[model samples]
Target: MSDRELRPLRSIRITGDGRCLFRSVAYGACLRRGKHPPSDSAQKELADELRAKVADEFVKRRGDTEWFLEGNFENYVRQMRKPHAWGGEPELFMCSHVLRMPITVYMYTSSSDGPRIIAEYGQEYGKDDPVRVLYDGYGHYDALQPSVVRTQSRL
Candidate 1:
């Protein structure tokens, strides 16, 4: 379908106004990193397909909004298919923001220490944690969508 046909979901980074967030995110991948990725010999094709389909749906449903595809897919794939040395990290859980969004949406990478950050901040922090520390504590992606993420992560 045409880009215009795509719809935009509510999203933004409060810290930057409309300067930071993205319309949507590839959360499924975020939850499935390390376990599933485009580099895995068994899951490469499936993961790629899923990623593409998700991207298509994202574009179709929320393409109208400001968005960006940020994930460790490229690296994940490389680490998975090296023929010998196979190792790679999962998709990042934090530190991703689309140019048009209002609040930051971070999937929390390993270095960020998601669980610790969550415990220190609480779910509310995930929504508007001015410090922007607790992105993972927002109640899985289902309960704490972007709205909640914004409410708590407001800086």
Candidate 2:
């Protein structure tokens, strides 16, 4: 999509804790389901839950994932299961599998370029709708929502 078409995205900042990725995904999942984002405590709990699920997914798909995983598969899964563990691309991919939904990651560029898609996961599951998240190019991630545009009606 063109920059203009995608300009409606509004980012919801997530806590900068190590679980930011999982928290962003959890927030996006809520918005994808047409629900409001949860409270901070709830989000934290949800993030931890998702983290555990992603680790389980890694184990469940170890036959397919082991080769690409860094270090021993057992160690990787063990680290990912930790509540405060930082998540990255590998966890994002597994999040898609665990949630059974597509995830579209975006990064904001210069003013002229606006926000652009950085990576997308789980397209095989479905592409019609994807949970959107914004990556700040550092280690942090935030949930994105399409801004609602209301047109003024003339009296």
Candidate 3:
């Protein structure tokens, strides 16, 4: 969101954040060696405090709120907790306002099915709805690859 409060067409992610995740990925890879990996970046210091703040903040604003991550991130976060720094819970950032979205072959049991899912999640809109669910969606790792994106763009 901007000063005008209009949602942007795309997110503004700095390469530094990408490097941060890459560092985590490298750390994850190094852990395959069955040893505690050495820290290589300054991101770890503020990471937990930031995540806790984000989670707590989400919890505060979550009453009757909905959120979307645009991927099957919840499960991946569960499988790789330390790397992602996400607690293994679908409702990790519990808030009435935050509706968890994980793009997967499986939808959450809490959610209703079909096109109605969009209407239900996006009901905040009056005549025109703001929320949408593109079902049969991509998984966590599928989204990371450029090939999947190229194929998806044609759709």
lDDT of 1: 0.27
CA lDDT for candidate 2: 0.87
Write candidate 1's Cα lDDT for 64-135 as tens digits: 322343345444344433332211111111212211111222355667433222321122323332212123
> Where is model 3 poorest over a 10-residue stretch in terms of lDDT?
139-148
lDDT values, one for every candidate: 0.27, 0.87, 0.29
Candidate with better lDDT, 2 vs 3: 2
Off by over 4 Å in 2: 1-6, 153-155
Better of 1 and 2 by TM-score: 2
TM-score of 1: 0.23
Off by over 4 Å in 1: 1-39, 67-155
Q: Mark the regions of model 3 whose C-alpha exceeds 4 Å error after superposition.
A: 1-41, 67-155
Q: Model 2, 11-106: lDDT tens per residue?
A: 888898899999999998988888888889989999999999999899899999999889999998998888878889999999999998999899
**TM-scores for candidates 1 onward, in order:** 0.23, 0.91, 0.24
Candidate 3 C-alpha error for residue 47, in Å:
1.6
Judge candidate 2 at residue 130 and give its lDDT: 83
Given candidate 1, what's the lDDT at residue 68?
42
Ranking by lDDT: 2, 3, 1
Among the numbered candidates, top TM-score falls to: 2
